[model samples]
Target: MAKEIERKFLVRSDEWRTRAVSSAKLMQAYITVNEDRNVRVRLIDGTSARLTIKVGKSAMVRDEFEYEIPVQDAEELTSSAIGIVIEKVRHRVPIAGKTFEIDVYEGFYSGLVVAEVELESEEDHFERPSWLGEEVTGDRRYSNMMLATNDLASELIHGVSHQAL
Candidate 1:
């Protein structure tokens, strides 16, 4: 199992765009979810796909099992997903040596943008970009799982974000 460790943040402005080196459209959905784990499938740029199983309860670390699956299989899984299929364009920006994947959501979750930096360990150092707003690493509300499964419109309609962080 891969030990996944990362931190999440809200994007404050468009400054990160100037630094982004690459971007890819992503379509992902969950097949199963629980307090401790989730099974998900992702279609990247509609050409490749991956099935991922994330286990563990730590806020910054998890046991991640990921596999490359046929796009057809991924499409089948997505068709029967438990909630809304997540649509986003992931922008990769290298800041101070660490690459941050900034996810700009579309569809029902439009207007939401988040940046994540994967780390080798929970205590590893990562430089925060000026465009980074607030750290939302442990906040479940900003989680992709919650965004897919919850009725967030009511919670977020007051403004651009419920976690407008």
Candidate 2:
């Protein structure tokens, strides 16, 4: 069992773009979603795929089980997904000796950008980049699961302007 601990923040500026070391285009879909657990399949760069099962209620910590699978299998899973597929470009940025993943959303939720940094434990400490905006770590509305399951973009940020950079 892998314990996933991470902090999430909204992107305030594009400064992180200059520091991005690598990036990947990802498409993900939720196969099953419950209050405490969820199953997700993600395709990376249209070349690789992974199936992840996460269980827990904590906003910053969860039991995660991920396995690589054939791209074809993941593609098939999308048809059975509970909601719309999510599309984004995730950039890896190294800052203050830690790596952060900046996800710039696409498709239905285009222009939405968020950054996340994985930590070793809930008590771990890290630096917050200037490009990072408000910390949305515990905000359920900023969660991928909620964003995928919910239909109203207005609920996330009124008027959908948050969808723009």
Candidate 3:
């Protein structure tokens, strides 16, 4: 199993932009947006079909298996995916002797910036780059999977509502 252990954080400033290489813009939308549907057809590195269920706040139960579906069938399945859309560009930069990915969102999440660092293990250690701000790992609100399903404008509204209250 390929374990994807990583830490997320808020970018302190835009200085990291100087180190950016290029960015890939993408917009992915889930079919339903707020449901817990777990069936997914992921085209990562290679083509694969799998079913994953959220196990916890930051964990998922994934089972990748063989697939024999045709392209049309595959598209149909993916089209039914709950609002899993993410529209953004990923900025790659080297920081602290390691590569950090900064995601600049667009569309509904136009002003949000998130950074992530992948690790070999959950216990991995690393230097904190000056540009990295507070760690947001385990913060549900910062999770891209959640953001894909949420209304970006609603988040801003609630943020201001909290201050007013």
Candidate 4:
């Protein structure tokens, strides 16, 4: 099984922009989202797409399976997604041998920026950049599945600040 282990954080500054190696426009939506698992369809750069299934009850780790799918199918799935579709620009910033995915949200989630880094293991060590803010690794409100289902107001009430930067 494929295990995904990552840490999440709110972006506090724009310093990461300077170090960004590349960026991709991403649109994703959940097909099914529940406490136990999530099924997501993601289109990247309007060219490629992926269908991902993640299962597990833990916030820090999950069993992930991803498959490349036709962009047309992905687009169709996105339009029929369960709730709000997620729109964001992901910038790949490499720092201290680790690449951080800094996502700047758009649309209904404008002004929210998050940074995430996948680790080799749960115990892997990594350096935190100055632009990274409070750790939200285990915060369910920050989870993409929850973000797709809830609005800004609901997220704020759950401790996700609009003034994150």
Cα miss at 69, model 1 (Å)? 0.4
lDDT of 4 by residue, 1-165 (tens): 899999999887788888999999999999998888999999999999999999999999999999999999999999899888998899999999999999888776777888999999999999988888889999888888888888753454345454443
lDDT of 2 by residue, 41-152 (tens): 9999999999999999999999999999999999999878887788899999999889999999888777788899999888889988788888999998888888888874
Q: Candidate 1's residue-wise lDDT over 20-117, tens digit each?
A: 89999999999999999999999999999999999988768999999999999999999999978999999999988899999988888787888999
lDDT, candidate 4, equals: 0.88
The TM-score of predicted model 1 comes to 0.93
TM-score of 3: 0.66
TM-score of each: 0.93, 0.94, 0.66, 0.93
The reply for model 3, stretches above 4 Å from the true place, is 31-81, 152-165
Q: Looking at candidate 3, what is the lDDT of residue 104?
A: 73
Among these predictions, the greatest TM-score belongs to 2
Give all candidates' CA lDDT scores: 0.87, 0.88, 0.59, 0.88
Tally clashing residue pairs in candidate 1: 0
The lowest-lDDT stretch of 10 consecutive residues in candidate 1 is 156-165
Once model 3 is optimally superposed onto the true structure by TM-score, how far is the C-alpha of residue 1 displaced, in angstroms? 1.6
Q: Rank the candidates by lDDT, best first.
A: 4, 2, 1, 3
